[model samples]
Target: MARLELENLTKHYGGQATVRGVTLDIPDGEFLVLLGPSGCGKTTTLRMIAGFIEPSGGSVRLGGQDITHRPPWRRNTGMVFQSYALFPHMTVAQNVAFGLEMRKIGRAEREARALEALRMVRLDGLADRLPRQMSGGQQQRVALARALAIRPDVLLLDEPLSNLDAKLREEVRIEIRQLQQQLGLTAIMVTHDQEEALTVADRLVVMAEGEIRQIGSQQDLYERPADRFVAGFVGRSTVITGQVREPGLFESAGGLRLRCQGATAPGAASLVLRPEAIHLDPPPDEHNRLEGEVTFASYLGPVLELHLRLSAEDRITVHLPNRGGAGLIRAGDRVSIGWPQDTGIVFAGTA
Candidate 1:
């Protein structure tokens, strides 16, 4: 395993910056995920680390050695591409051994390492099968084995599970996380899927446009988002734009008063309420209560997602557990919702 560092790493195309001054330190054996929406520089940053794209400025260090100018072949990094990038004609074992062969390892050692890597991913039995003969999940494991066969200092996964079906994606992500932890590999994955990042990463770096928004564990980001964008992106949140009227009060744009916590300096702010934090038919003594007309309801197995309109300009989403009687609330129904003051996170911004 190796510790990786990016120092003021930047990328530009035609004078337009795509990645801006991203400096991060990834400790040894840490599974760090770069998470953001499309075109947000997460993939570019991963490619830069893999030496597939030359940075416009800054440096990349691996295991305390400067490798900013090193070619991809010389960086000792293994990359699993989004497409699985397997050779159609080559058998699984051949594909996995390709990297070892490229490095001129002897034939016997390459074969041994290929089988070992395949075994690691539980695909050794199908080593002789062609890529086209296997399932998508199997092909993905072949790609993973190929990367691991190289015995790289760092493993880079670029949207590794985006091609699988929902069930397989979840299964493969669990496998990947288990393999990563078992091997203690210093891995960095670039993904737009928040759930995948939450499942696999030890720490997450949330990026936007060309810079980082926040970096934290799954619980930290979900429970205490740094801003409106993160609160909405990382999880489900009902964001209310308004101004702080006092230390414990917020007035929404629609003129609804709410009891909140976490912001003191009363300027323009946004109240971020997690959907799960709100409860239906709160008691009379509840600190924060609101009555809204249910606009829509979605039954999602264990939970019912409700969209409610508080007024012409204000709406909030609430998630109620799908316990025995949750189906009673439906569209057009007037519902009373309430949450504790501290349940709402108030950030000092409107945009």
Candidate 2:
């Protein structure tokens, strides 16, 4: 395990920068995720760290050692791609032992290590089977085991679970997290899936257009996003356009008054409220309430996601835990939705 750092890293393509200056520090044995939409430069940054791509500027360091110019094989970094890049002709044990074999490890030692790696992924009994003989989830486990067998200093995963079915993805995510923690390996993963990043990473770096928007714990990003992009990108958020009505109050374009508990640097701003924070009820003379009509509703098993359209303003979606409010709300229902002034966050409006 090693501490990784990216200092003022940048990459350019055809005269336009794809990865603008990015700087981050990942502590030893930490699980860090680079999350964003496609073409956000997350995978590019990972490739730079792996020496698959050279950066236009800045440096990459491992355990305080400069490794910006090292080749992928020389960097001692293990990588698992989205496609489980296993050898179809080889059995699981042979696939895992390939790396050790390349390093000229003794045959007996390589076999022993390969078995250990297979056991770590709970696939010891399947070592004799070829990759085609296994399911998608099983092939994924084999890919992971192969990466671990090399015992690299840092583990890099590029959307490792994107190919699996939903149930298998969840199961494999838990397994991967457990194995990383147990081995105390430093790991970095890149994914566009918000749930995967939130569930697997100790910290997340949200990026857009090659620039980092914010980096923090999952709870921190969800509860206190630095800006509108982070708020919308990290999870479901309702944006209310408003100017600072006063130090702690805001008036929406639709004439809805909201009290934002989270303070912002003084300026024209907007308030972003999480769906779970807003309460829906009949009209009440409350300090912060907005009346709206439910325009659409969908039951999401655990939660009912309702789209509420405020008079003359943008529609917002609110998620209600279906278990509690399953029979309470419906489409076209008149409702008052609002959060305490202090429950929402005020962010600077982009010019």
Candidate 3:
């Protein structure tokens, strides 16, 4: 295991900057995830760290050693690609032994190490089977074994679970996290899946347009977002616009009134509301009160989604739990809903 460091790392293509000056210091044996949407420069940044692409500026250091210009093989980092890049002609054991063979280990020792790695991923018996004969999950295990055979200092995964089905993806991700923790490996993964990042990453870096938006644990980013972009991107948020009349008082042009529960300043305010926090058919409260007509309702398994069209040209989405028909409300029902004083946050700006 080793600590990874990136200082002012940057990359440019022609005159456009793909990755800007992003700096981060990751501790040893930590799992860091780079999460963002498509074309967010996350993959480019990972390639720069892997030494596959040279950076335009800054440095990459592993365990206090400068390896900014080192070759990919010399960097002692293992990469698990999204495609599961394995030689189809070779058996699982042979493919796993290829790394050790490149390092010039003897045949007997290389075979032993390959078997050990296969055993770690619970694929020892399938060592002789070809990738075509195995399932997608099995092929993924073979790729993992190949990456771990030479025991590289760091492990890098690039969307290693995108191809699998929903259930299998969850299972494989859990196995990967467990294996990483058991081996005490320093791992960095690049992914756009929010749930996957929240599940496996010790910490996550949310990036946008080649810049870092926020870096923290999943709870920190989900509960206390840094800005409007972070709040909307991290979770489902309903933003209502209004102007603050007093410290906690806000009024909209269509006669919608709101009183937030914090030390807020008087300005244009955005009331950010989470779906699960709002209750239905409640009396008018001092904090928040609104009446709306349900335009649509979707019956999800565990929860029911209610799409409400409120006054003031505002819309609100509510998620109600389905505990023995607790969500027995239908469309076109004019209902009054109120939330607690702390259910919504008042950002002193409109979006």
When 1 and 2 are scored with lDDT, the better candidate is: 1
Per-residue lDDT tens digits for candidate 1, residues 1-351, read: 799999999999998999999999999999999999999999999999999899999999999999999999898998999999999989999999999999999999999999999999999999999999999999999999999989889999999999999999999999989998999999999999999999999999999998999999999899988777888899888889999988989999999999887778889998999999999989999999889999999999899999999988899999998887658888999989999998999988778
Give one digit per residue, the lDDT tens place, for model 3 in 172-267: 899889999999999999999999999999999999899899999998888777776777777787887777788767676455877666626777
For candidate 2, give the lDDT of residue 213: 94
- Pairs that collide in candidate 1 are none
Q: What is the lDDT of residue 72 in candidate 3?
A: 92
What TM-score does candidate 2 get on C-alpha atoms?
0.94
Ranking by lDDT: 1, 2, 3
lDDT of each: 0.93, 0.88, 0.87
Predicted candidate 2 versus true structure: per-residue lDDT over 281-321, tens digit per residue? 62466557677788888888888889999867767788877
**Model 2 misplacement above 4 A:** 262-268, 282-286
What's the residue-level lDDT of 197 in candidate 1?
A: 94
Please give the RMSD of candidate 3 to the true structure.
1.9
**Structural similarity to truth (TM-score) of each candidate:** 0.97, 0.94, 0.94
